[model samples]
Each structure stands twice: as C-alpha cells, then as structure tokens.
Target chain A: MSHSRLGRRTLMLAGAASLLTAKSGLTVPARAQGLQPTTSMRGGANNYRPGAPIVDRIGGGGFLMHGTVRRAGDGAPLEGVRIQIWAHTTEGRERDARSHGATLTNADGVFELEMPQIVPAFGQPHGHLAYDSGAFETVFLRPVMDSARDASLAAHFVLQPA
Target chain B: MTLKHLRAVIAWGGLATLIMIPIAVAANSEYLQYRGPIYIAAGFAGIVALAVLLVQPLLAAGLLPRLPIQLGRVVHRWSGLVLLLAIAAHVVGLWITSPPDMIDALTFRAPTLFSVFGVVGMWALLAAALLAAIRKKRWLRPQVWRFSHVFAASAIVAASVSHAMLIEGTMGALSKAALCAAVLCALIWTVWQVKPWRGVRRRQNSRR
Candidate 1:
C-alpha cells in the first residue's frame, strides 16, 4: 500500500476511535455515575435473621469475611456495628444456626470474622451477611468469592440511616 | 494412523484444547454458587461462543487441515447459528436471573461499563448475521458484503474482548487474557490472508 493510503487509513481509524470514546462518555447518567450504592442487590436479603444466635466463628476456622462499614453519600466509616454472616459450609448449611455468626466492626469500621470454608450448595461457594445493628438501614449482602480456594471474601457496606 | 489422519487429529485437537481450556479455568469461580441452571447454561453459551471464535477464522481461511473448504464453510455457517443461539440464551438467562439488570444492559442504561461493550457486541454480531443471511439477495455486491462483514467482525471482537476483560467474574485472568489475545491473532491472520481490502479496491478500480 502507498504511504498516503496507509496514513489516511490510520487517520480514519484514529478519528473513529475518538468519536466512539466521546459517544461512550455521553452514555453515563448526568447526576449519578458508575456503580452507585443500591438498597440491595437482586437475590439479596433472603432468609435474613433466621434466629441465628451471635457466635465468634462458624465451625473450624479456615476462611474469613471482612469489609468496612461506611455511611452512605459521604463514605464516613462507622464503628461498633454488628454484621451477621452465614454460609453453607462443611460444618452446616446456611439454615443451620451453627453456620451463622456475627462480629463487631472495630474503631476504623473494619470487621473480620473467621469461618469454615464455604461449601458450594445450590450454585457456587458464597457467604451471606447482614448489617444487623439497626443504626443503618438493613443491607443483606450475599457475596461470592472469586475462587473456591480463596480463603477470604469481602462484602463492604455503604449504609443509609434507618 | 496415516500422516494425513495424524495432521487432522492434531489440528482439530489443538482447536478443541483452545476452546476447552478457558471454560476449565473459569469453572473454579465461586460466583457459580448463586447462579441458577439457566444462568449457568447461559454463561457456558457465551464462553463457548468466545471459544468458537477461533474456529470461524480457521474455517474461513481454509487453514484447518483435512477439512474441505466447502465443509468448513458449512461448519462456519452452522457455528454462526450456534453463536446466535448461545448469545440469545446468555441474554435470556441473565434476564431470568435479574430482569432490571438485563434490561439496563439491553437498553444501554447499565451502570457498569462492561454492559455497554457487551451490548455493542451483541448488536454487531446480529448485524453480521443479518448481512450473512442476505448475502444471496445481492443488495450488497460481493466486495461490499465482504468489507461490511469484516468490519462487523472486527467490531464484535473489539467489543466482546473489552466486555470480557472488564468483568471481574468467573474467568481466570491469565487464561481469559490469553484467549482474548489468541482470538485477536486468529482474526488478524485470517483477514491478512484473505486480503479483503485488496479485493474491495480492485473491484472499485475495475468498475471505474
């Protein structure tokens, strides 16, 4: 191909790319942009508060559930909040109170709980959690880990006041 | 087995390995727990669709040893149909899992950027299919059809690769990246071999 032909094609490609990028930018909503904090995800909040009493660990400890508790909008970390967690583990199913536990967030809003490795039941390995402190609007999160072999899963809460 | 059969086996086996490895890598994903059967089926359909991309270019270029070009073309056509069904299942299954999310993705209101590229790819694939289906109508001349098909194919690859790369979901990062890279290479090689651009310019010159 001639140099001018190649150069023109390159210029045309560059022009098309810029146009597409500009068009994509226009698709974002005006007021709110990106993945905003929602009330709850679909399939979330199922079987919340099934009479599981507070415990430190759910069976033999091998995996962890950890995240920060932050207030909505301004993202202020809230301390001393109780987060309830459950999963179908080698020890028990999510329905079993023995598979449930709760932990309080530290002063930095960080919370971590040791739990047995979640065993996949219905679909894949996952842990369910709820912010049960009543200070914030109840948010039930069912977080799935990236890998079954991973020892940790994170479910952060950005809460709205009740 | 004869050398001919061995080459055929090697060729087909290599392609199948490329297709199957990514699915195996993604099987370890924990997100599969919450997904329903339909959703899982849908996920597989999409994964397979991506994998089958390797075959299309090979078939189009007549690069697959022991496969006749005529047979390869027929397989290419059927695979295109399968791709359409897989994509439909993927969308419908996701819709069943979460209607609002699927609707957002379909309508371009989805909050995540991945949905945008995915939606773009879906439409491009659909357009390419439509173009292929009407290739007999002669609405577009052969050169025009070839150019448009190549354009649409490129769009589909670009969009799907972007969509796959953005989502931090089931796929293993390295395997997914490798698959995406291999797809790009196959497509580039096929297009280079076919030299569809040269045909278009030559046809225009002949017409003048």
Candidate 2:
C-alpha cells in the first residue's frame, strides 16, 4: 500500500482515538446530542430564559398564558408570573414566523393578543409565548382545564424588535 | 451476492444525491422560490441519514442478511457521504441564503439541534474514514480501531436522532411523527444488535 494512504489512515485513527478518549466519561451537551432549543423570552437584557411557546385557550375577555412556572428548588405555582405574548405570521414560502411585536400581562398576569390575524409572505399559522420576561421565546403552554376536562384552545402571539 | 442488490444500493445512493444537490443550490440562492423546498429537502436528508446510521451496526453484525455485507458497507459509506455533502451544501447554500444560520452552526447554537448533530457526525465520520484507510499500519492495532469505530458510529447515530427530534420546522405534519418513530425503532434495533453488555454478562457467568 502507498505510504500516503497509510498515513491518511493513521491520522484518521489517531483523531478517532483521541475523540473516543475525550468523550469516554464526559457527558455531551444536550445541544450536541441533538436537542435544538428555540428562541427564549427576554426579561430585558439581564434575566433570559428559553421560552418554548405553547397554545393556550382564552377565557372570557382577557388573555392568559395558563401554564405554571415554578422555582428551581420547590414546585410551587409561581404566582404573579408575567408572560409576554408575541404574535405574527408568514405567507407560505417567505418571511417565516418572526416576532412582529409583544403584549404584556394585566393584574391577573394574563396577556391577550392584540392582532388575531397576520399576513406575511408565504407564512403558516402559529403563535409564540415568552415567560417570566426571560429570554426563552417559545414555551409549552399547557391548556387550562375546564369542568369537562377539555383543552381550551385559542391563538397566541409574539413580540418583535422594532 | 446478486447483481440486483448492488444496483439497488447504487440507485438509492444516486437518487439521494440527486435530491440533495438542488436543495443545496436552492439553499445558497437569494431567489424567493428556493426557500421552502430546500428546508423540506434538508429535513428529508436528515431522516434518511439517521435511518442509515441506525441500521449500519445491525448490518455489520450480520443481522440483516437480506442485505449483502459488501453492499451494506457501501450503502453505509455512500449514504454517510451524501448526508455530509447535503449538510455542507445546506450550510454553504444557507450562508448564501441565511447568514444568521451559518453563524449559528459555527457558534454551536443554530436554534435547531440539527446543526450540532451534523457537525459532530461530520467530524466523527472524517476520523472513521481516515482510520479505516490505514487499518494495516502495525502501530495502530486492529482491535483499537474496531473499538473506536464502534463508539464514533454510536455517537453519530445518537446525535443525528436527537437533532431530528428537536427540529420543529422540518418534517412537519404526520411525516415528522413517522420519521421520529422510524428513528426510535432503528436505534432500538442497533442497540440490541451491538449488545455491548453481552460480553460483561458472559464474563460474569463464567466467573460464577
């Protein structure tokens, strides 16, 4: 066999060995393992949390995020939680689900979307929610339960930079 | 083996390449028409690559006899190359199309985990290929190469599956759910075939 070919193989083997050794006991980051995170809700520039936008059903007049947020150590309903709702849409092949603008919470810590319908270039119909003013732009908004145990469904929104 | 099997592998690899090239070109262009289809195409490639990676170990252990060993190896290598090329094309094309994503891939935070998975797969593959080329080198024993190759292959498969699961935009609708199922099944099959723990059990039983 050609020395050059052998050398190429040797280099490859060395690299593989090193990678295997390095990764032996180390835990690969979730991202490295294929967990893609979406944009997060931003509480100003300081406290940022990854926000995974979920669908929530609106009750009566005001909008509500309807999901529970808790402290790290204890699982308690983080009362007075403020969630910012941003909304927008694209036409189909263009624009994308970019955040158009944001809406804040009221006394009940609920946010109602102002624009129900948006017309972007080739956009699909979707909504996003940000929690705790953290950086997480999307969240898994759990549906509020009714007496019938059915999911109350409604539109959600996102806030974009101007 | 039969000539038909060889033909099939080549054809599949060729078809995958054909599907991949346009997506690359489209991704790289600024034209409005190129965006949606390429996004869809990249998603398909990811699913296919994950499937192939998941099946490779089973095929290696002689679990899939319907596939010829040589053909299996060829399919694995070629499919891997196609996946890598598609990713590179997607990245380069997207750079032309979406510079932010290109930056995200480099920075290791591309919103979607696909970029992270792709990057690791790429590096692992490159190393595996290099070592396989030099298997006869006296200093690098065959056993060492074998162990490392197994680990790298596992990483590639695991990363690819994770990337696919995390992605929201690609493979939307029922197709996405189906792809997820396929990945999970293949992963299960691969782990079973490898049976990395089997050796430990055998040793323990003997000691007992």
Candidate 3:
C-alpha cells in the first residue's frame, strides 16, 4: 500500500472501530461531557447531609478528610466555603448525625476535619462530603479510603460560582 | 508474500493483539498511577491473561489460519500453561498487596460483587489446568476429561469476563469490552464446532 493509501485505510479502520464501540456504549466518557472538571462523582452524592453544621472537628479517633477548594473558572482558592463531610466510621454509619460534620475552607482554600476512623461499610471504606452551602453549586463526593487502616483521605473540590 | 508467510504474519498478529491491550491500559490509565507496582502488575497480569484468551479457542479448534491443528494444539498447551501462570501471578500479587482483602475475596466475605466471580473463575481455571496434568490417569476417561475441560473453559470465561467488567480500573471500557467480546466469541465458536458432546460418535466415525 502507498503511504497516503495506507494512511486512509488506517483512518477508516479507526473510524469503524470507534463507531462500533460508541454504538455499544461508553461508560466513563458518556457522562463526562456534562461534568465540570471537578464534579460530584458517581455515588458521591449519596448519603449527603443537606445542612450539616460546621464544627471544629467531628467525634475524632483520627481520620481526617481534607482537600483544597478551587474555583472552576480560574482555579483560584475559595475561602470560607463550607464542605460537609461524613463517613462510615467505628463510631457510627455515615447516616448517623454524629458521623457527619462540616468544615470551612481557609484562605488557601484548604479544609480539614477530623472524624472517627472510617471502617468498611458494605466492604468498601469510603467517606462522603458535600459543598451544601450557597456559595457554589452543590457538589458531593464519595472518596474511597486507600485502606481501612489509613488515617486520612483527601477530597478536593472545584466549585462553580452560583 | 507467499501464503505460508502470510499465515505466519497473521498468527503473530494474534499474539501482538493480546499484548497491546494491556500496554494501552498500563501506558494510559489514570487509575494505574495511584497503584503500587505490585498491584499494577497484578492488574496487568489479569488483563494480559484475558487478552490471551482471545486466541485460545481459535488454536484449540484449529481455526487460526495457516497453522496446522497439531502444532496449534501444542501452542494451545503452552499457552494454557502461560494462562495458569498469569492467573497465579495475578492472585499472588493481589494477596501481597492486601492480605485482608484477599482473604475476604477468597472467603466470599468481600462486599464487592466482582470477588465472587473472580473466585469462581480462578477455581474453574485451576480445575481445567489440573485435567491436563492428569490426562494419562487410567481413571480419567478421555471423554470425561474433554467434557470437564469444556465445561471449565466456559465457566472461566464467563466469570473472568464478569470480574473484569465489574472493575472500574485501568482498562479502557471500550477496549476492555471489545477484548472480552472477542474472547467470548472465539470460545463459543470453538465449542460449537468442536462439539465435545459428539465425542464417542465422532471418534467412531474417524476410526473407520
């Protein structure tokens, strides 16, 4: 096959392959078109507390959920933003009022809240958080713990200005 | 090119296809970066094994173009051994990565739906591999061996595909599904053509 001919053939084959897969279905990219750079992940919004209060730290045996909150447009850090957090912990399930709490982002857009050590609920160790306040569009997160033994999980959020 | 060379090229292409799927995942997947090296290897081993399976049934039924059925059988046996080893590496690597999780997986205590299917596939593969090792045993009739191996093959493919599908991992969903579908198609086609259920009748026909 000549260089141009071979290239055309390859392109056609690639197109066919993509069309076949696209018709079959796309799992990750199908929902990606509608999402912000940092948005609520699937299952992230589950078990969110609509108005959980900001506290110094939740009942703590020491697992901290912390991350930076950035603005979606310019990536600027947003301060005083409330990030509500909860998890299935030794103390209680994620739905339990004691297991849920909120923390405010500081000047640098970093927020951290100490809570009871998260245990695997339904065989998955995960924590849920939501940016429930009016400052930004609501974003919820369910970050799986690296391991049940790990003492912390970091969940960063980029908020779109409402 | 001569027909013989063309056949050889096609045969090698099958192997290349098997290797490329895992390479694509390892090189491009965002999830793999977060994983430890051992865990990554385990994940790749599973991917590689699944890819290899695409060519397996083709070889067994002598459908791969240009290769003789006898040589294909030989390659099939060797590939079977590779499949066994790859699966072993995958399980062992995972165990080293997390003993508690592996235990949960093995004991069916894992909450994740994938673990049960994985366990089933792994055990089925073990059973299939064992059948080959005991091929010469007097108690093991050839007919029985063939039936059991065929049964095990389908179980392995079904469970392994389910396990792979359930995982949200390094493998691209489209490519992963394509590879899996190819493997299933190859297996079903081979089983249908081979028709192990006709064992005695087919053998008797050949005797004449």
Candidate 4:
C-alpha cells in the first residue's frame, strides 16, 4: 500500500482498538444523562449588546488581558489604536457572558482592560483570572450571537508602521 | 513506517476520531451541541493523556522486568506518542472550533476550574515532551532529564484529573466526577508503583 493509504489504515485500526477498549457501558450512561439547562438567562433573554468598546482595569484578582499593541515592523507601541473584545460560550448560546467592546490604545498604544466573561448567564460557571494580580476571579462576559466585525481583530490592536 | 508502526498509528488515530465523531454529531443535533461536544472531548482527551502518563512509568520499571522489557518499552513509547497526539487534537480542534475559548484557556481566562486545569495540564505535558525529545543533548544529564520527565508528567496527570472533575454537562455530574476520581487513583497508583523517589532515597542512604 502507498504510505498515505497505510497511514489511513493505521488510523482506522487504532480507532477500532480504542472503541474496543473504552468502557463499553458508558454509551447508555452518557446518553441517559441530559443537559442541565440554565435558568439564569431569564427566559432566553440577553441584556448585553455587541460592538461597544471597553477598557477594564481588572486589578482585583480578575480577568485582565494586559498587553501593548505595537507596530509590527518597528516594535513601537501603537498608541491610541482601538482594541475590541468579544466572546461566546461553548454551547453556542449567546447571553450576557460574552459582552463585546473596543478601546483605544493609550499613549503607548498599550491598553489594559479586564476581559469580560463568556459563561452563559445561566449555565456552567465560568472563571476569570487576573493576569495582573495572579488571583482567579469569577465574573461573566455577556455572550455574543452575531457581530459585524472579526472578534480577533476586535481584541488585537496593531499599528501600521510608517 | 514499518507494518507494526503503521498499525499502531492507525489504531490510535482511528480511536481518537471514533470517540470524537459521535460527540460532534450529537452536538449538531442538539441546541447546545457545540458546547457539549467540545467540553467532553477536551475533558476526555485530558483524562486519557493523564492515564497514559500515570500508567507508563510503572509498566516501564515494574511490569517490563517481569514481562518482555522490549514489549513494555514499545507500549510506553507508542502510548506516550498517542497521548501527545490526543492533547494536540484536543487543543487544535478546540482552537479551530473556538478561537475565543482557546485564547481564554491559553491566557487563563476560562471560567471554571476545568479550563484552568486543562490549560495547566497542557503546559506540563508540553514540558515533559520537550524533555523527552531533548534527553540525548549533552547539556541535559540523563538523571536530570529523568527527574524532570517524571515531575512534569505527574503535574500533567494531576492537572488533567482536576479538569475532569470540574466540568459539568452531558457527561452528567456524577459520571464526570467519577472519571476524575478514577484518574486520580490511577495517578496515585502509578506514583506508588514506580516509587522513582525510592531510588534516590536508597542512593542517599547508602552513602550515609
């Protein structure tokens, strides 16, 4: 067999082996269990809006993504550049936990802000750690379902070199 | 790759896909599909990787001597490789699926203990793999490399178990907790069985 074909065959066999080895009884145990719905969302209603720029200080053991956005070529901090942030929960359920926003770079093109939590308003508990203070903080960023701009570009602030 | 190597690779790859597929399919079926599958896959992959780390050293030192040493070595090395792949899949798949969560987990902004543990476990596993890959370099003494390997692997297992325990979703609270306990027990067993520290103690005592 060709190397690629051999590789595919090997992957298949490994899958079979793992299936055979897995605790055979978990299928029923897995399916019988149901999703624990969160009531905290207040009737599928979301209060958070998308596309508002925010800069959170996140000093008290909280969610802070502190960084400086600089020009890619010159390595100079891109002052006053805007940075936006937004995120959704794992379940695709948009709620208050994924609040989105944007903030301008400070004099150094450096911005410090607490990232909002992405946990559902009524779902599995989420955590935010303050990278600034080294303590875990519990807070929720409102969830986002749809937005006009790229979330990555929203979160990252980069300066174009002159 | 040799026939044997090919077989091993196939088996590992197939198994990972099989385990992951149903969950992905199930997610599409349900309203909260993506959430359930991603969390479960991440948790399961971490647990399995922990199991590999917990089980291997004992098999290498204890069972290997009793059985065929070469066979034991093969299992250890291959499974270790599989564990690395599983972790890679867990992170890469998740990254592709959700860039925000990946950033959150990597940056330690995940909401639950599970995410924290998962991230930390990933780092530990990475460190251990790095040591293993570079063990033969002149700068790294064999003894130092061995100690670092054991320490990093142990950290990975512990963090993974913590992660498994902390997640809540389709796996059900009880089953998820049980998996975590089982993983912890396996970790403890491996540590006790290998007793890598015992050798250090013996050497020190002998000198005394």
Highest lDDT scorer? 3
1 or 3, greater by TM-score: 1
**For residues B1-208, what per-residue lDDT tens digits would candidate 1 score against the true structure?**
9999999998788777777778997786665664557767777777887887767777866878988889988999998898899889888877775565577678876556778898999999999999999999999868889889988988888888888787765677788888888888888888888877755655444655
Query: Tens-digit lDDT track for model 4 on A1-162?
Result: 545656877899989877876757444453443322111211111223344445452112134444556554346655655444433433233323344444556887666555433343112433221111112111122222222121211123233322
Ranking of predictions according to TM-score:
1, 3, 4, 2
* Candidate 4: Cα lDDT at A104: 59
Candidate 1 vs candidate 2, lDDT winner: 1
Q: Which should have the higher TM-score, number 2 or number 4?
A: 4
Which candidate comes out best when scored by TM-score? 1
Residue A19 C-alpha lDDT in model 1 = 89
Q: What is the lDDT of residue A4 in candidate 4?
A: 64
Query: How would you encode candidate 2's per-residue C-alpha lDDT over A76-144 as one tens digit per residue?
Result: 223444554432222222123233234444453344443333221111222344444544333433221
Q: What does the lDDT read for residue B79 in candidate 1?
A: 89
Tell me the whole-model lDDT of each prediction, alpha carbons only: 0.77, 0.46, 0.79, 0.51
Error of model 4, residue A82, in angstroms: 23
- The residue-by-residue lDDT of candidate 4 on B30-131, one tens digit each, is 324435456546545644564465456645554322346677767777787889998987787666545565676788765445678888988898898787
Compared with the true structure, model 2 gives a TM-score of 0.45
Question: Residue B62: error of model 3 in Å?
Answer: 1.6
Task: Evaluate residue A87 in candidate 1 and report its C-alpha lDDT on the 0 to 100 scale.
Answer: 79
Give per-residue lDDT, candidate 4, residue A18.
74
